[model samples]
Target: MIENVAALAHGFAVALTAKHILFMVAGVCFGLVVGVLPGLGAPNGVGLLLPLTFTMEPVSAIILLTSMYWGALIGGSTTSILFNIPGEPSSVATTFDGYPMAKSGEATKALTFAFLSSGFGALFGVVVVTLLAGWVTRFALLFSPVEYFAVFVLAFASFIAFGGGSPLKSVVSIALGLALASVGMDTISGSMRLTYDVPDLIRGISFLVVVIGLFGLGELFETMQNPAAAKPVATRLDLAGVVRAALEWPRYGVALLRSAVIGCWMGIAPGGPTAASFMSYGIGKRFSRNGPRFGKGEPEGLVCAETADQSAGSSAMLPMLALGLPSSATAAVLLGGLMIWGITPGPTLFSERPDFVWGLIASMYLSNIVAVVLALATVPLFARMLQVPFTITGPIIALVCVIGAWTVAGAPFDLWLLLLFGAVGWLMKALDYPIAPLVLAMVLGDRTEDAFRQSMLLSGGKLSVFFASPLPATITGLALLCLVVPLAGMALKPRTARSAAP
Candidate 1:
């Protein structure tokens, strides 16, 4: 504990320097713009700015990108709270309750809660990162290919059960992600597995291209097509509401803690903030007096969902930083960003480059506070952006998506892939296939495949050897349960429905 404290102290000294703080502020400022604009997410924004960092010192570059990451994560809640749009993927659930509060004329208060609670949740998560990343890193390093593959199986199971609509369709999307993973040349052998004719296929589809198409590009198309779907203009808030939210802050302390706790658990588990936010909102509704009229405009629901989503987002950084396992699409891009900068994130990162680790850890604290203060100060300005017409907004979204995609590789091929995935994403949304599972599958597929093959080779092609290891046995068992629970639930559905019938 003392050593960790000492490290944090040193980190603060390094991070609080004027030069570093200015860079951190710049990153936060950039991230807020990225987060406010539809179709310009954290990953794309960071990826676009990564090259510019190459000329700077490694630590500064990391601080900038990582702060941008936290800023974007924090800024996403603003849109979710004020407009029904989620500026980023993780904030999607915040819209369930946040927008209602805005319509009810609690826009300033809702924005306040979102920003402050996000700061609280981020602190909770960063504390965990400081105290627990070492242990988590050790554990992560112990996993082999078979273990990772099993974990991947567990990851996909959630979509099957909760993806909504046809389970088969979700499964198909997962399969498609796996297929896309196979497009790259075989790493072990020189021979290509599925790259038909194109040389770009040799490296396979870029995850960023895929994500941009599915999210930014795809959403742009959807917005343009929905000509009749006009966005509601939000009214400006007086300064009084901000003060009111602060005065009521003490009352919601318990709820904030509750949401943060739930968010951490959800982040660490296979389920994500989408689940966490709804779960927290449900609890608030059941317990709070205003629960009955939650959708009609209630602060409790807004507080619950916003806090949970931000908390979950903050905690999601842990798996990626310590274990080299990205818990979300944004984290995956972050992982890629770290690699681009030649900073390999994992156990060795702490030991080999304490400056980078502590600097980043320190930046989290600085950025979290900056995000809250900046968001609160700028909420009024951001809230006005909702007034942009669909024609204008839709084209800007397309432009950002195209530019982000093109910047990924500076290749026309990536633009083509973006167009392709945009179409696929539209189809997936239309067909009710969950995009989350597809992203999870894409990010983990390569690692899982590598693990599976390595495990087979290690076992001398005797697959039974996989069951021999305790970790493998445990992971496989859990994965089996993940798969079985959905089927079992489906099987029991009819009997329960019949029994409940009058």
Candidate 2:
């Protein structure tokens, strides 16, 4: 324990360097800007900035990226509270109570609770990363190809099972993502599956292009359609309200902790912050003493949503760093960044690069503190941002999205892909289909297929190999149950509806 503390202290030494601190602040400001703008979540935000870090040292680069991630998570709530716009997808739930608080002229109360909860969630998640990532890596080392494949299956299964809205839509979304992922040449067979005759298709579609298009351009189109989205609500930052909310923290402490746990678990799993925020909101609504008050400017709902958003955003890094698995689309982008920097994340990564791992962990702690302070201090500025006309802001955002996409490989094809995916995102929103599942599948499909194929090769194509080991069997069973439970619920829905009819 003492040794671990010493290592963390040493990591702080590395992270506290003048250069690193500057990068952290820069990343946070960039993230805040991205987050305050609708449709630019962490994945698109990080993707946009990743190219600029190519010239920096790997450690400094990651510090900047991760700090940007932290800033984006906190900044998302700002727009949600003040404008009823979810700056990030995960901030959707925050708008439930946050916007209402603003409507009722209690914007300061909502902002204070939201920011404080986000700070708590970030701290909780980083502490887990600092103390638990090594142990998590140690445990992940025991996983074989079969077990790893099962874990991947479990992730997808959990999303399909517990993800709200239509299960059929979720399944279709996953299929679409998988189909997109299959466009590139097969790594093992060295053959093409989905690509047309275009030479650019050989490289497969860039995930960054797709993400920026879907999140950035798609959002721009929606905002363009709705001019009312740019209208600002009146807000006041009452210090007295902030102090009262702080004193009332104990009242919402249990809910906060529960939301944090849900966020952490979802982050380590595949559901990510969107799922975490929604799930935490549901759970909070279920158990809060103020349940009836929810969605009508309820502070508890704000606590649940904002806390889960930050917690899950932070905790999503655990699986990425410890096991080389991305728990969310943003994490997938960061994972790609790590590989770009020649740092392969896995069990061996910690032993091979203690400085990088610990420095990142230490930076997370400091970054959260920095984000909270900055976010609180800048609330008035962000409120003014709500008044920016879409005509001016929309064009700037569109240009940024285009540039971000084109920068990936300097390929015109990527720009086209961005437009295509942006249209797809718009259609999905129009159809009320969930985009999260699609994003996850697109990011994870290749790795999941690779893991499954590797397991099959080890077993000489035996199907039973997936369940041959205890860990694999257990996880596979859970995956199967996830699928079955959802199906069963759907099957019973008609009968239940008939029975309840008048």
Candidate 3:
């Protein structure tokens, strides 16, 4: 540990140079723009910047990319809070409470809570990476397809059990998402399952397009239908509110810690930030004293979702760095960049290039701090955007949604899909169906199916294979508990009330 600390100090020296700091600022600025624009996510941002880094030194190149990642993460929550649109897939959970909070005239508080918690989560993840890198790498290596499947199941079960709605309705929402996810050609079967003779369907639907339709266009439609709702709600962006929100951080200590732990675990494993955010939000809803107000502009919910999302995104870098396994799409791009730079990832890389490794880690600390400052500075700008007359902002949002949807694949077909799903989203909201579960299912459905099939193949169709190992068995057991306990509580609730009746 002492040696790691010493090396990290040297790394800070490497990352603190003027040239590297400039790169960090530039990367963060560009990334914020990428993140605030739907359909242009971190992975794409990193990929676009990859060619530009080809001439730079490896450490400088990496610091630039990673800084952009932090900036993108912080920026994504801005749209989720103010516009009910997620600039990144992992920001979806933030929209649940963030938009509601902003709509209730607390945009400053929501943005402040999100940025502060995000900074905390990123720092927590970096601390883990600095201290426990070796242990986490080894633990991550223990996960097989069976364990991966179990983890996905556990994520799903947690959401369903604690999602705070009709369990049956949640199930229905999940089923719809899964069905939508399966529209493309089957990965293993080499045949189309749901294309139904449509060539465009062969490539499947983009999750981003669906999200834009559901949250962005859908919200627009609702407002258009009710002109009264189109009137901009009063919102203030003041230093006082930001300071007050920061001061309230201590009140949510439990949520911050829990979410950070969940994010790190999911990042080290294969759950990714999207799954981590959803799982954290679900668990937060169940455990928070403000549980009943989760979907209704609760600050605790914003803290939980943003904390887990940022932590997971940051910790995901560890596996890509130490084990040659990319835990997320952006990490995969970073891994590619490492390979391009002639740096082979694995246990040996740490010993072979401690300077590079530690420098990247140190940069995470600095970059996240920069991201938070820049993100906070923009809170007022985004808050004031909400004050724009709906007639103008609404059309602009719709046009942005349309452009975002078209950018998914440059296919005209996605435009129609956007409108269809927009109407579907409006209908679902009207019927009071939970949208988060559906989004979660859509995100994990394909990965879960692939993992499950691989596990089945390994076990030759025997279900006992999941229990053949301690890790998978424990995770599967926990998933079952998550499913059963909440349902059992619900079942007993009515009985207990009857017994206590006068």
In terms of TM-score, the best-performing candidate is: 2
Instruction: Quote the lDDT for 218 in model 3.
Output: 66
Query: Which candidate leads in lDDT?
Result: 2
Q: What's the CA RMSD of model 3 in angstroms?
A: 7.5
Write one digit per residue (lDDT tens) for candidate 2, span 151-202: 8788778778877666677789888888888897998899987788889999
Q: Give stretches of model 3 more than 4 Å off.
A: 1-118, 129-133, 223-363, 430-432, 488-502
Give the winner by lDDT: 1 or 2. 2
The true-versus-predicted C-alpha distance at residue 356 of model 2, in Å, is 1.8
Q: How close is candidate 1 to the true structure, as a TM-score?
A: 0.89
Error of 1 at 334 (Å): 1.3
The 0-to-1 C-alpha lDDT of every candidate, in the order given, reads 0.75, 0.84, 0.79
Deviation of model 2 at 342, angstroms: 2.6
Order by lDDT, highest first: 2, 3, 1
